[model samples]
Target: MAGNHQQLLQLTYIRFVILFCQCCAVAFALLYLRVDLNPWATGLALLLLGLLNLITYARLHSSWPVTQPEFFTQLLADAIIYGFILYQSGGGTNPFIFMLLIPLIITVMTLNNRYIWMMAITVTAIYGSLLVYYVPVVTALSEHQHSLTSLFNFHMLGMWLNFILTVIVITYFIVRINRALQRQQQSLIEEREAKVHHQQVLALGTMAAGTAHELGTPLSTMSVILHEMRTDSTLSDEHREDIDTLQQQVQTCADKLQHMARSVAEEKDSEKTSLATELLDEIIEQWNITRPDVTYSVSIQEDLPPDLRNTTALRQAILNLLNNAADACPKNIEISLRWEPTAIWLTIRDYGAGLSVEQTNTLGQPFISTKGKGLGIGLFLTSTTLAHYDGDVKLYAAQGKGTITEVRLSRRSVHG
Candidate 1:
């Protein structure tokens, strides 16, 4: 955090106006009132005060923000300038002497008792010194009270009371209100970010559905072409095996798209069954076909729960994780499925050129990714998909030089 540089700048401008008024007051006493005063001494003092404020502002680099101590120092300067004005006018008898409290009021708004007490002591010392020695601005004849002097004194006292009361009221009530407002602003920012994240996830789901629809015809054509090539008479035995593998992979993709379509149509069946194989098995088979370059092993607990039945969604999310792992570590990957009493835990460990622990932990954050060309949407969507089922994904550094990702799902998701 920059130390309140914005607030400091704002206060600095307000102080300039105060300093300007003090400078003008001295000029008014000498020229208009024709009072006996040391014009050059007081005039030069006020000028130096303004110069110090300007210097302080100039010294504030964008990188080096003004701190609490620096802000306190500015307030101290204000008190000193006010003290100088009082000394030339009439010591504690100056009409505008209440301006010294301006510094104290600012300190109340921005600093704690420790600094406030320090300021109080400093101002008290200056006021005490002004009482001992000061140049009188008003003549001795003018100081002698006239009938009009009593009325003028009453007016000055009223203004002083009003200024002090206003400062106290604002410090007590407005400071607390401002703090509450800041908290509300922070909450609104967080809520806005969450809404944007949710919208991005929804848009990703829509795009996936549209892509599945568009690819259906092209996949069918590819399957037919592969089938015809397999039937050719002169094809070698090795070539025939490759064609069979390619055909099966293409058919698996088609089946996955069909399942995704069914889920989208909201088929209201409480349960679903596939020919002899479970949903989890079908997912693994499809994933294995897609990631043919990497070797992966899966382990299941003794009494595993049934699949959540929306295999395409979960399958696609896990596929994103596996694909990310493959990109990071191509040699080998290990997947472990363990069943807890209330939850199911799935872990994917990769052993290749591993990323840093900090890098892996931030895998699913929007716009942040470990991959060179990745846009970071894959892991974001994966995390969002798992969150729908009351699940979470976490990434960690492996024991050696690799990354490990663990995903946990509430048991109710599978059990339901």
Candidate 2:
């Protein structure tokens, strides 16, 4: 993000230079044409504009906040100054009236549509007012100087036509370019999400393999104890039955551990299942074990339709939210899951320190986290997963209160 800002600033500086150069070029052209304006006044205005452009360029190069409102405020000021120069040189009769399109073009490219429209309206008003005030002055000056009335009228008409045509062309291309850029940005975001998901899968597989390896010894010892108890000759019939039951229970646990290990081993090689209930359950159980001090409660709606229940990504996203809630409020974390006709909703409520307005706004953005030791991947990944399935995650918080994170998935049920 910082790099992107730097790039934008660089581009802005280049634009400033380009505008300055264009102003200089226009001034030179006017001098060559021997316009009626004072050469000294035009030269002075051009010099002032060039100096302002340099200042803008220097400021953008500095480490100051590029998005600061003041930055754009100054840019608007510079644009107005340039417009005034054009007005002074020829007013409505000036061939340079079409140059007013430059600032409007820059505004459209750099700002939101609403801001662009506001600027357009403002420029139009300014231009119209200038024309109204300058038309009679220009006409009087031309007549006093014995200038040809027909030629002056023709020039004025040409300038108006040029201004109209330039505005139409600039607006059309700017909107088209903005839409194309938006699509490219969306594509880049999707690609980054895919990479992050793949990375997470690799990390989970590694953790699972390590956990399975670590649990092997304890399961083996339990198995040996059960074997010894079953073979003891001194055991009574009732005792033997109890021992048999104990052995079966131990065997079941061992089978589960082995299955987990196999699953981890096959994670990279095997295809993923559409239904992720087992995976979700395992994740919850693991979190329960890891944070035994935390009281965690999860309620999945029993009537969840097949379509909603079958989405692996949605399950993982819900699990991530649950885990984040548990981590936030270790002593009292509650998660509830429900299904509606159009969506599946998972809410994780925590009694920990609530987020501020700023944090809430940037909740799922990368590197924006509230926890001290948190890598901040949990919520980001969950948000990304939800987005992939045409879903959303929302965080609500109040002052001195807790946070409620709601994950909403599009599919309502797995029944379909």
Candidate 3:
């Protein structure tokens, strides 16, 4: 992923350099061909713009990471500089007034919804103010002032029309590209998750099978001992009763082994059970038995939508979250579930030693764990499953308190 991002950056830089050189050549040719204003000022402004572009490009290419904020700032500077040049040259009369659309187009291409709106508003304000302020000045300076009046109107009208049309085109293409990239990313993530889940299921199945095989000898020996005691005529009634109890315990263990084998075999198949409330109850019961030292309080809101109730991935994800909470709080744990119109939220809070910044940063990543025997698959699987449903997991250590893990899944009613 890092390599891909670096390659994308290099390509973007090359494109920016090419576009900058082209714009410069066009500006110089226009100055030479028709308008002979202050060449010195024009040269200076062009040189400064070129230098800014180079500096921005260098910064982007250097070791420093290019975040969304820095990208927007650079784009905003580019637009303002370009717009200033166009205003100085002729304002509404300049054919290159449409160049203002360049930054807006790039903004739509590279930014999220929030930054796109910011760029749009910025462009509208700058262009509107320039047009209101500079139209008369441009008209007065032309050689054919009377003729220039009509020509200026035509040029300004044409520029606005082109700006709107270009913006529409750019927005359409950029949205399509963003959707495509998102789909590709989601597909890759799902494929990786499937592979990991398959491996885990395989490992678990193998272990279960081995366990059952190993217990076969002990089970047979116990059965033989019980039968021999029962057949002995000299055996006391108390001894026979004891043998019967031992035999019953052995049978119970065998039954448990068989159940585990069945579970493992079922997991090997692709079938999944629905996420009924009973599943949650089962999880709680199992945890209570396994971690008797831990106290748990769970509440699932009654308002959850019917569709959400059957979401197996979500159910499993919640179970994992609960497990993590139980681990964190060997003493006290609280989990709450709430259903809103827009989302379903599950919060698991524990009063234990909270995670450090570094540990939190590595959370949900495979093979990153604080436990000695941890493979770190639980959180990774949980995160991946939640993400599939357009859900998110947030981990935070409360101030002067313990850690909290919040899992939020977009409501099917809203998202679908």
lDDT of 1 by residue, 1-416 (tens): 24256546655666676676666666665665556788777777777777877887887655786688888888788788779867877777666667777677667766779989999898888878877877665543565443457547644864575476446544544465356547756878978977988988778778888899899999999999999999999999999999999999999999989977887576445245332125456666777787778887777776746445454566678778888888887666888877667777878899867778688667778778788899878889888878877898988878867888898877677643
* Residue 366 displacement in candidate 3 (angstroms): 0.7
Instruction: Compare candidates 1 and 2 on TM-score and give the better one.
Output: 1
Which has the greatest lDDT? 1
From the highest TM-score down, the ranking of the candidates is 1, 3, 2
Candidate 3 lDDT by residue in tens digits, 146-238: 465666666666567556655654555465556656876788898897787667656754765787899988998988888887899999999
Error of 1 at 15 (Å): 32
- Please report, in order, the local distance difference test score of every candidate based on alpha carbons: 0.73, 0.64, 0.67
Cα lDDT of model 2 by residue, 1-416, tens digit: 33334434543554555455546545544444334555565567667766776676677667766562454465466557656666665566566576666667766566567667766887787688677665222333443433587657656765675566556555655665566567668878988977886777567557757877888788789889878888889989999898888888878877887765675466445534343345456567766665677786767767633344434445456767766776677767777767676776767788988888888887776656788888766787777667766788999993466888877767633332
Per-model TM-score, in order, reads: 0.44, 0.42, 0.43
All candidates in order of lDDT, best leading: 1, 3, 2
- After TM-score superposition, the amount by which residue 413's alpha carbon in candidate 3 deviates from its true location, in angstroms, is 8.4
Judge candidate 3 at residue 102 and give its lDDT. Answer: 67
Model 1 regions lying over 4 Å from their true place: 1-179, 234-239, 266-349, 356-362, 365-376, 389-391, 398-400, 406-416
